[model samples]
Each structure stands twice: as C-alpha cells, then as structure tokens.
Target chain A: IPPPMRPIPCKPLFFDLAGNHISYPMDEIEEKAGTSKKSPKKEGGGITGLVKGLWGWGGK
Target chain B: MTTPTAAQQKKEQEKQALYVELQKFCQSQDDTRAIKVASKILHLFPNDEVAFKTKIVCHVNRGMFAEALSLINDTSKLSGSVQYEKAYCLYRLQRMEEAKSVLDSWQSNSFKKVELMYQIHYRLDNFESAYDSLSDLLKTSDDEMDDERRTNLSAIAASLKLAGSSRRVKDIQ
Candidate 1:
C-alpha cells in the first residue's frame, strides 16, 4: 500500500450522527478491505451517503 | 384472582424468563443456542445489545454475510465487543477493504497488526505472507489461547498447506 493510499485517521459525521471516521468512500472501503455481508441498510434519507448507511431511520 | 389476570401475569413471567435466558446465552461462547436465543430476543427487542451482537456473530459464523452486514448496519447498541465480532464477520465475507477499515478504526488492539496483515495477505491471496505473519504472531504473542484459538491456528496451517499445493500445481500447469 502506498503512503498516498493510506486513509487519514480522523472522526467525522454522517449528517446527524457524530464521531464517524469520514476518510474513504464506503465503496473504496469495500473494494480494498472488503465489507460485512449484512451491512447496515441505508435509510430513505440523505445521510446514507455518508457512513455507508450506518445511521438512518431504519436503525430505530 | 381472575383467570385473564393470571394468564397475563404468566405471559409477562415467560417473557422475563426468556429475556434472562437470552442474556445468559449471549454471554456464553456457544454459538448454536446463542444464535437461536439471540434471534428470538431480537424479534422482541431488536436494539438489545447482547441480542444484536449474538445474532450478528451467529450469522457471520453461519456465513450469512449479507444478513450479518445488514444487522451490523442497523443495530446501534453493538458498540463494543460486538464491533470486533462485526469486523471478523466482514473478513469472512471477503469484504477485505471494509473489514480493514472497520478493524483499523476499532478501539481494540486485539484485531490490530498481525491479524490485519494476515487478512490483507489472505484477501490478496498472498498465502505465503499470510501464513508467515500468523506464524510470527503465534511466536511473539504471550497470551495463552485455549481450544478455540488453537483450532483456528490449525485451520490456518491447513489452509496454508493447501494454498502452497495449489500454487505449486499452478506452476506445474
């Protein structure tokens, strides 16, 4: 892995949620390292664009 | 005492008993019953931490990767040990990049370094490196693993053998 490819370690938000690391895109994350099969579903809202739908209305 | 009131009380008692049993099952390392119990609990209290984690672990163990991933995404109380379990589930699913990202961001040192290296190498099919790194990890670690870790080590060793054989066969072909 190149140094440039290394994701920066920092916490960011996905719309309403807080403390999520917003370094790389979820697709890139899935491509490079892979993802869990039952990933969280995106709620019918905008925040799903952020942390791969880790936060949304459906979670509740 | 009215019969209806008695029946309601019994139902509540049953629910409470089931909840206690679910908690016990969640704490136990036994995946089979734990999964069943957890799933039942989730059917009742979907956000319960123990139940959610147990369900995710069970699904991942069963290779229900898509279900496990969806649950991980949906549940919020799986904030601690459950997160580590989710990471392992991700690895089993072959979502290496997401697995790596989650593992990297995790607060637990347990999933760091060697496992990450091995996972990366495994995803890349760099079997030699994966085996060597895991072997190195066993060599360096001071913690004594009981039956389960030893069993996983055995499996990794066997896979390494198979990987080596296949590589050789490929060369011959």
Candidate 2:
C-alpha cells in the first residue's frame, strides 16, 4: 500500500509592515540615486506656441 | 375699396393685418409676441380699440388677469362688446364682485348682457340665480329674440330645469 500523505508546517517569511509598501525617507533615496525633480525651462517659441501657452495659463 | 377715404382704408388694412397676427399668436400660444405686436399697433393708432382689446386677450392668455383688468378699465371708451368680453375675463379670474359691478352698470336688455350675466352666475355656481336672471331676460324678449339668441335661451332654460329637478330631489331625501 502507498504511504499516507503527511502535513507540512512552515513559519511565515514576510511581514505586512506600516501604511503602504513604500517606506519613509524616499527623497533621501532619490538623492543617493543622483536624480533631481526640477522641470525643464523653455524660451519663447512661435506666436502660435505663445498663444497656446497663454491659453494653457488661462485654463489654469 | 374706392369709395372709402385713404386714411380709413389704411386703418382697415392695419386692423386686418393686426387681426391676422393676433390669430396666429393665439393659435401658436405665443403670448409675448402677441403683446409686442399689439403694443406696436396701439402705438401707431393710439385710440385703436381693437388693438387694446387684443392686448387684453393676450394678457388674459398669459394669466396676466390684473393687467387685463387695468387695460379694460376704460369702459366708457370701449365698445359694449369689448366691455362684455372684459367682464368675461374677470369672471374667469374669479373676480365675482368686479364682474357683477360691471354687469350691473351694463344695460341688460340685450342678449349679450344677459349672456354675460348668465356666465357670471354660472361661474359662481349660482345656477338658480343664473336661471332666474336668464328667465327674466327671456321673458322680456320672447317676441323680439332672433333665432340664435332664442336657441341659446332655450338651452339655458333646459339646463336650469334639469338642475332644479335634481336639486329638489336631493333636498327632499
């Protein structure tokens, strides 16, 4: 006859931490990664682009 | 066409056109447009009774009964038929005192006056009063009434009889 199957018990390897999956001090990590969050600046373009920019500013 | 004076002919044409516009507005339920057009007509011919009458009708259609009463207040200048029509509007607006006062001032020998009084009484739910008044008028004009007026009087009399019998039976039980 075949042997009866045995049950297996294992300890949990991972724990659910605090509020979200991400930890605090993310900006410190970003600095270590050599990345900056500043947006690119632009000079004046054509009249159409200027008008579009004015419209965008108006919408805001 | 040729015999009438130019001014008279022009005034007739204007009245005809105004009447057409009034009819159109009435059928289309365009009370605001009717008031504007009637106002313009009155401006052109200040003493035009028909235009003023049309204005009252427009006001009445728009549920502006107060305006209609104010416009129709110049009873001395208005034709008898116009005053009668104004009284009808007052009756519809449930202004029984105003309607009664106007009808009292009117001479009631004519069929129009009798009809107006009958309408007032009928609207007030005073069927017996209407019957009495109509009977008095019909009694006075039995020999002289034309066919249409006589027929109307007869119909009212029949209605009064029916109402009277039903009312008497109800009272008896």
DockQ of each: 0.02, 0.00
The 0-to-1 C-alpha lDDT of every candidate, in the order given, reads 0.52, 0.55
Each candidate structure's count of clashing pairs: 18, 0
Q: After superposition, how far is residue B71 of candidate 2 from its true place, in Å?
A: 1.2
Tell me the tens digit of each residue's lDDT in model 1 across B1-173: 69999987675455455645554544454557767766765676555564565566566556676877777776655645455556656666777777767766777655244555465666666667655666666556555432333443444555556556443211110
User: What's the CA error at residue B29 for candidate 2, in Å?
Assistant: 4.6
* Interface RMSD, model 2, angstroms: 44.8
Per-candidate TM equals: 0.45, 0.45
TM-score of chain B alone in model 1: 0.56
lDDT of 1 at B150: 42
**lDDT: which candidate is best?**
2
